[model samples]
Target: MNKDSLNTDYLWFLIIKSLIMKNVDLIFNEKQESTLFGYVMKETENKDKIWFWVTIAMTFFIMLLFALPTIIIDPYFHYHEPLTDYGYTFYRQRYSNDGIVRHFDYDAYIVGTSMTENFKASEASEIFGYNFIKVPYSGGYYKELDHLIKRSFSSDNDIKMVIRCLDYTLLARDKDAEHEEKDTLHPQFKAPEYMVNANPFDDIKYVLNKTILFNETYSTYLNIRNEVPTTNFDSYSNWCSAFTFGRETVLGEYTHTDDVQPEKEFTQDDYEMIKGNVEQNVIATINEHPDTTFYLFFSPYSICYWDTAHSNGTVKWNIEAERTAIELLLECPNAKLYSFTNDFDLTCNLDNYKDQVHYGEWVNSDILVRMKNGENMLTKENYKEYLDEIEEFYSNYDYSTFAVGNEEQ
Candidate 1:
C-alpha cells in the first residue's frame, strides 16, 4: 500500500461513518420506541393531529359566521320572538302566512287573490269592528283560500271575520287545480304543516339563501326607518292607491283599438265540476265556521272579461256557476254574498282597471265600503235579477267596436 491508497481508504471510511450516523438519527428513542415507530413517523403523526384540529376550528368558525346568526335571528320563521316586521314586500308569504296568523295580533283576515290586496285592511277593520290583516295570494284558488281559512281558525288569534274576495276565474278551475305548475302550490302559499311542525330544513333553506338574506337585511332597514315599498298598500296609513294612472289614463289604456277573443270555452261538465268544487270547498268552509262572519264577494273584472266570456260561449256557464255559488253561500247563515261583477259603472269604465282583470285599489276600497254598507249584495231573491242584468249588459256590449285596437285590451 502506498500513501495514495491510504488516503483513498481514509476518505471511504469517513463517508461510511457519516452514512451510519445519518441512519442512527432515524431510529426512535428508547423511551419513545413503544409510542413512535421513528422520527419521521412521529413528525407525520404530529402534523396530522395539527391539521385535524385546524380543520375542526375552521368548521366551527364557519358555523359561527353563517349558521349561528341564521338560527338565532330567523327572519322567515315568524314564531321566533323579536320578529322584524319586514312588511309584505320582503315577506315570503308561504313561509310567513301561518306564522303571521299564529303570531300577529289581528282579528279579521282579508283572503283573496291580488284583487283583495288593494282592499284596505284598515278600512275593513273600521267598518267590521275587527282588527284585520290582508293575506292576499296572487291567483289563489279556493283550495288555497280553504287552507288559509282553516289555518286562521286554528291559530290562537281571534279570527272574527273572513273577508274573501272571490275571483271568478279561480271559481271556474277544478277543485284540485293549483295556481302554479306541477299541481304544486307556491312555497309562499303552502299549508302550515311544515311550518307548524317546525321543519328545520325549511328554516335552513331561508337562512342560507342569498335572496332571503338580502331581503331580510333590507327589510330590517325598512322596519327601522318605518318605511314601506312604493308598491305596498299601507293599511295603517290608509294608502290604498296602487296604480300610476288617473281615471282617464286607465280608461284610455284599456280602450281597445280592435276586437280580440281572449276567452276559452268550458264544457257543461266542466262548469258543473267547478260549481261542485266551489260548494264543497267554499260553502263547506263557510258552514264550518258558523261563529265567524264570512263576507264573500265576487271581484269585479272589466267588461272585456265578460265580453271574452260571452264570445267564448262560457258566459252562461259562468252565470250558472255564480248563481249556484250565491245560492249555496246564502244558505250558510254565517255568509254574506256580494257581487261586484255587474258593477257596470265601474267595470265598464276601462280607466278603473290596470288590466282586463285587475281593477285599481279605488274599486277595491269601494267594494269594501259597499260590503260594510250591505249594498251590491246578491241574495237568493235577487241573484236571478242581478245575473239577468249582467247577462244582458254582456250581450249588448259592442265588444267588436272596443276590441278593434289594442290586443291587450
Candidate 2:
C-alpha cells in the first residue's frame, strides 16, 4: 500500500497490459486480410449487417421484457379491477396468436367511464340474466362511450345490451379538458373506423401512455395487487370484501368499499369539455342505436361532500345536461333514464360519500339495488333499510351542506 511500492506495481501492470494489447493489435491486423474478417467488415458496413441486426433484435427483446408483461400479463391477471381504480393510461387491448382480441363471451356490455368500470359484470349478469362484460375507459365522456360501444359490438354479434353510466360532473362543457383517445395496437390489428378517425392529439397521447412510456415509469406490482378476476357474483363479492369491513362471505362480484376518492379539483376547462363531450355523445349513441335500450343513471356521490360543497350552478348545469341527455334518449324510443338523482334520497348526500364524490359501502349497495331494479326507483325507505343493515355506517360521516339545489355543500 506504500506509494513507492504501488507505483512499481502499477508500472508492471501497465507493461503487461501493453504487451497484451500489442499482441491483440497484431492479431487484428492479420485478420483484416482474412476472408471471414473481410466479409464481416463488409457486412458491418451494410445496414443489414448481422451485428446491426442483432442490436436491433436485442433492443426489441429488452423492450418486450419490460413492456409485454406490463400490458398483457398484468392486465390479464387484474382485468377484474375497476376501471376507475387504475389510471386511464393503463388501458390496453392484448393480441392473440392469431391477432384477435380475446374477450369474455358476454351477451351484454357496460360502456361508460370509470363509474361503470367498477361495476362487476357478473353482478349485471345476475340482475339482467345475461353475461355482462365492461368495455370502459377513463373519463367515460359520451362520445368515447359511443365509440367503444361501436367497437365492442362490431367485434362480436352476440352482444345484446349496452349499460352506460352518466354523472352530473361528466357533463361540464369545459373546452380545455384534455382527453386521451388512442388505440395503441391499431397498427397490429384492424380497428374500427372511428378509431382511425379520432383526433390525432388524443391518439398520440394514448399510444405514449399505453405503450411507450406509461408502464416503464409507473409501479405495476402495486396496481396488480388491487385488481383481480371477476368472473362471477361470488368472486366479485370476494374481491370487494377483501377491501371492506369484517369477515363476510362475498355473495356478489363487486367489492363493497368506499375507498376511491377524486381529490383533484376540476379545471374550468375540464368542466366544459366533459359536459360538451357527454352531451354530444349521448345524442349520437341514441341516433346510431335507435333500437338499443339505453339505461342511464347518474351514479350517486358522497352526501356530505355534495351537500356541503356543490352549489346551485353545479346542480343546474348537471340537471340541464341530464335533461339534454334525456332528450337524446327520447329519440332512441327504447331509452329510459333511471335517474338516481331523484330516486336515491341520499343521491345528494355528501357525508355518506368516502371522499369529495365517492359513496360509502351501504350507499353503493343501494345503487346496486336500483340497477337491479331497472324500471322502478328504490324508495328512500328501502335505501334506508340497507343502511340499517350496515348499522350507522354513515354515522361518522362529515356533516356538510351540499348546495345541490341552491348552494355549494
Candidate 3:
C-alpha cells in the first residue's frame, strides 16, 4: 500500500505490455512478408510448390467444366459421331444453317425471311421432286438472303431449285449497302468470316458463353431423350394464327381475326431505293445462277399492308417495282415468277394473316401447290394484266372497315 508497492505493480504492467507488443509485431511482420498468409499461407518452399500445382489443377478443372459441354453437345456441330442428333431448339440459325447446308444432302433450298418459314419442306420435296431444306431468317434482309442462297448453291450437293420469298422492305435499301444501324443482321449471320477462316480459337467465345452453354446443354438433353423436334421445318410447326387478341401465344400458336389496318406510307425515293436493291441483290443473284431454277414470289402481305402503302403514297411505286422485278426475272430463262401479291382473296382476307405482313402456313402451302400445278405463274403475257388487276383492286378497296375501333360498325 506504499510507493514501493505501486512501483512494483507498474513494473509488472510494463513487462506484460512489452510481451503483448512483441506478439503483435510478429503477426504483423509475418503477414507483410508472406505472399499468401491471411486465408492460405505458404510458409515453406514445399507448400508453395503444392499450392501452385493446386491452383493449376483448379484452373484446368474449371476450363474443362466449360469446354466439355461444347464438345459433347456440339451446338456448333463442330465435332461428334454421325447420327448424334444435334437438336435445333436452341440452335442459332445463322451458325447452324451453314452446317445444315454442308452436311444435309438436300438438292433444293427454300430461303427467305420469316414469310418463308411456314413453307413445308416435306410438301416442297414431294411436289418438286427434290430434297428440300428451309433456311429462313426471321427479319432477314436481301444481304442475308443473298449470303444464304450463295452458301446453298456453293454446297457439295446437287443444287436444284431455290424458292425465295421476296421481302419488300429488303428492297428499300441498296442491295450492296449494309443494313441500317437499328436493323442490323444478327452477328451470327453478318460476316461469318470467322467461320470461313475456320478460326478454332475464336470458338472460345461460344464455348465460354453462359447462354450458349445452357442452350447447348438443354438441346443435348433433348436429343438424348429423343424429344427434340425435327429441324427440317425449324420452328414453323409451332406457328399458329397470331390474332388471338389479348391471349398469350407460344411458338406455333396463331389466331385468325378480321380487324387490322395499315399505318405506313411510302414515297418515290423509296421506290427508287427498292428498285436498286432488287436490281443489285435479287436480279443479280438470279442472273448469276442461270443453271439453277429460281422461284421468286412476292410475299402476300394482307390488305392492311396495302392500305398503309397507299397511305404512304408508295402503292403505285410498289406496283411499278413489282412489274420491273417480274420483267427482270422473266428475262432469265430458268427463273420463274409467281405473283401471289395480286391474289386478293388470299391477301385481302384478314383470316389468312397473323399480322400485316406474315401470312398463315396454309397460304404458303397453297402457293406451293399452285407453283407445282403451274397456275398463277406470271409470264410476260399475264404480268401486265395481273398488275392492272392489283392496282384496280387496291383503288376500289375501302380500308375504313378495318379501322381499329370500327369492328362493330
TM-score of each: 0.72, 0.51, 0.71
The number of the candidate with the highest lDDT is 3
Between 1 and 2, whose lDDT is larger? 1
Per-residue lDDT tens digits of candidate 1, residues 155-234?
77767888888777877777776556221234454443455444666654555544444345335544546765322223
- The TM-score obtained by model 1 is 0.72
The sequence of per-residue lDDT tens digits that candidate 2 reaches over residues 1-409 is 5786456446544644565455443333324645443446554546356556655765665444444434443333222232334422233422110111123456666665545545666666777787765555545455545555655544544655666777666566442333454444555543233132324444323222343333322334344465632234222212233343211211122232333333334455554555467546665555666556666676755443333323222333343444444444444555555555443456434344334454444544455567666644333334334324222333333333221232332
Candidates ranked by TM-score: 1, 3, 2
Task: Provide the lowest-lDDT 10-residue window in model 2.
Answer: 93-102
Q: lDDT of model 2 at residue 357?
A: 51
| Candidate 2 structure, TM-score to reference | 0.51
Candidate scoring better on lDDT of 2 and 3: 3
Q: List the residue pairs that clash in candidate 3.
A: 238-252, 239-252, 240-252, 240-254, 241-254, 241-255, 242-254, 242-255, 265-312, 266-312
- Model 3: which ten-residue window has the lowest total lDDT? 245-254
> lDDT by residue for model 3 over 129-217, one digit each (tens)?
99887877667688767766776665678787889888766666665775333312253335344433246787666566554554455
Backbone collision count in every prediction?
A: 11, 42, 10
